[model samples]
Target: MQLPVETTDSINKISELRNTNLQNILKKEIDKNALWKGLVAKNLMAIGIVDLTDMSNIKYAGINDNLMMYAASLPKIAVLLASMDAIENGELEDTKEIRKDMRLMISKSNNAATTRMIDRVGYEKIEAVLRAPKHKLYDEETGGGLWVGKRYGGGGDTNREPLKNLSHAATTMQVCSFYYQLVMGNLISDERSKEMLEIMKDPALHHKFVNTLDKIAPRAKIYRKSGSWRNYHSDSALVWGPNRRYIIVALIDNDFGEKIIRDLVVPLERVMKKARNLEKETKI
Candidate 1:
């Protein structure tokens, strides 16, 4: 899907600050580690990274733009935005129940809770919200996997396409761009953005990524979400620093456990910290 005109403009503005150093940084990372070999050994498909701090500086380490993988729980971020939009427009109230379910959907990756929240906001509303001024959603429609309704424990086939097929997935690039808009308060109200960040702060729900991050950079505040399927695994995070924010996305469709974590997570954290420090020093 084409990015909206306003979004294009914003992207152009951010792209002007493209950090060329990040390219060499990531290239050296991939070359230095044998984890890419392990990822291939496990039949991994594709991995893509986007630097949200500077949209124009995006780095794709694996396959090119054609690579598409199942979004899994990453789409929940879009759902969360839609729900918040509804609440802000007075179409839906931010009741205790709504807040509770939103928290569950985001923090816990609770499919049932997500479906319930989607039901409240309605699918059409979600679609419309994404097509709004500065947000966009791009993907294909395909068959066979976990239907949203059934996957969420609801009792209907809904005749909808299954959520799995690689053909019906999104690029890591698009997902990261969508998230950047949300983080910068361009997709929703500031109040809503703050609310969403608070939900992301829930350590219990974000344990998978946060736990690893805590070990390496305990003092850093990182907000992340992960998705997994039979052979695919992905994690996207916004690392908050004293002077800058960094976006890190790691995707592996392999079973190389410790290797994926060490090569991707550990080194990515180091890169992010170095980027953060450099930005602070340069006052960018």
Candidate 2:
């Protein structure tokens, strides 16, 4: 599937703004403390930062464009958009069943619920929606030659190659781009975007990401979604502050600690808080 292409003008502008500030932030971190080392030991990872106030202002640090890791639940944002688009188009009824599973798939990250939602939304429709202009959903399997096997009764593993799995895998850059597109009202209507944001606001589903942030910046309101598979884990979300909103996505593919919330999650959350504070002080 041909995913949506970002606008050249927007891309150029965002690239310039992000690149200009990215180095400064990195330098400050290196001078103050060596936080990057902790991130480095956790296998390969990527971080994409965007100013939610203005999509054109964006920054990417650490393997920004590299298609290195699996998307895992990160793609759920696309599924969420597809569901909202279906509802808006009157193609799928927002019946009780649809509503229930939509909540489960997105809010709770329920694998079975997500699978059923995928069946209802139809793979083709989801593809088309993502392939639209300025969208960011890409066909990972075709590019990497990876095969993702179906989940066995929700938890069992299937004999499959990591690259082919469509159920849960995506590049870090692609995932961040998707959120950017949504915030810009490029992929779906504004009303639909707001609806999706509401679903993301559910605290129950944001445990992994929120738990981390709560410890550091408890006052911030976070709308986020996270996914994990074996050694791979990802968290993507929009962080809201009194005067700013930022989009943060972090992916780690290594055995760090017992729980993702403790090891990778808290660290990422602290980094985000640090970034947010820097942005505020610098007024970038």
Candidate 3:
């Protein structure tokens, strides 16, 4: 999403402090609580959050934020962006079939649909977009952000992300950026990014973050993608609330990652709400 000139300037004001108020609150809860302590001990958890109320006044908070983990289905969002990019560039058709595939691939976590979309988008092309100077959603310096090197449900070993050599991979910082940029209209053209986000709306499979967030903010609107395989689970979303809009990305690499991700919802909900109230709350 294309952020306004001043909004872009605000994104530059990001602060990185582990002991900031929001960080302190979240770290205290995740560290002291049994629900999240085990994952932290295993070095299997990472998270990033961006307050998007003013775009320019946004602040970021994170823990293990740069750690890369097997992203599960979260990386499918990369393909979603790439597909829209192709459509915008006139390299692909914007057909009903393509739209359905994109929607299902995200909303339902459809592996087959993701494979089709990825094949059309091409792994190299997706990388190019992520690594592009403009987006930098995935950066070598940060050990990479979002990547899909293989088709979902296995196969295409030749395409796994180079940083971790995993079929799918992500970093908390990057996924947060993905949603942040998507919200800023920087992932693709403003119009195409809106269409892409619309495809992710009203998610059909609600199990991870969305499920837990629902427990607190029952009516919150979320556009998210989630994935779980073996012990790893990852979820990233742009969440909408009565007072603000924000992005939260969590990457976990343990058997209990989903539970840990879910457990974070309450504490995060509190911190996020308080943080936004500190700013001038802007309802999306």
> lDDT tens string, model 3, 1-284?
22221223223312332226667666766777774677766677887877666543566788888788888888889889888888889988999999999998999989999899888888888888878877777777877778887888666645776677877888888787777766666666667667877887779977888877777666667889888889888888888866547778888887777777887776776776676654445453
TM-score against native, each model: 0.73, 0.72, 0.87
Residue 198, candidate 2: C-alpha displacement in angstroms? 0.6
Q: Which of 2 and 3 is ahead in lDDT?
A: 3
Q: Any runs in candidate 1 off by more than 4 Å, and if so which?
A: 1-18, 37-66, 139-151, 154-168, 206-208, 242-244, 257-259, 272-284
**Candidate that beats the other on TM-score, 1 or 2, i.e. the better one:** 1
Clashes of each: 0, 10, 7
Off by over 4 Å in 2: 1-17, 27-43, 53-65, 139-167, 205-207, 257-284
| Candidate 2 lDDT by residue in tens digits, 1-284 | 11112333334322333454454454344334244445444445555566554334455443433354665766767677777889899988988888878777777887788777766776667667765555535544323211123441355433332444445555655666666655554556655666676677645653555666676666666777787777777777777755446666666665541244334444443454566576779975
Whole-model lDDT, candidate 1? 0.56
lDDT per residue (tens digit) for residues 52-125 in model 1: 44434543332222245565676677668778888888999889998988888877888889888877877667
Q: Clashing pairs in model 1?
A: none
What are the runs in model 3 whose C-alpha is more than 4 Å off?
Answer: 1-19, 53-56, 274-284
Most accurate candidate by lDDT: 3
TM-score of 3: 0.87
Winner on TM-score between 1 and 3 is 3
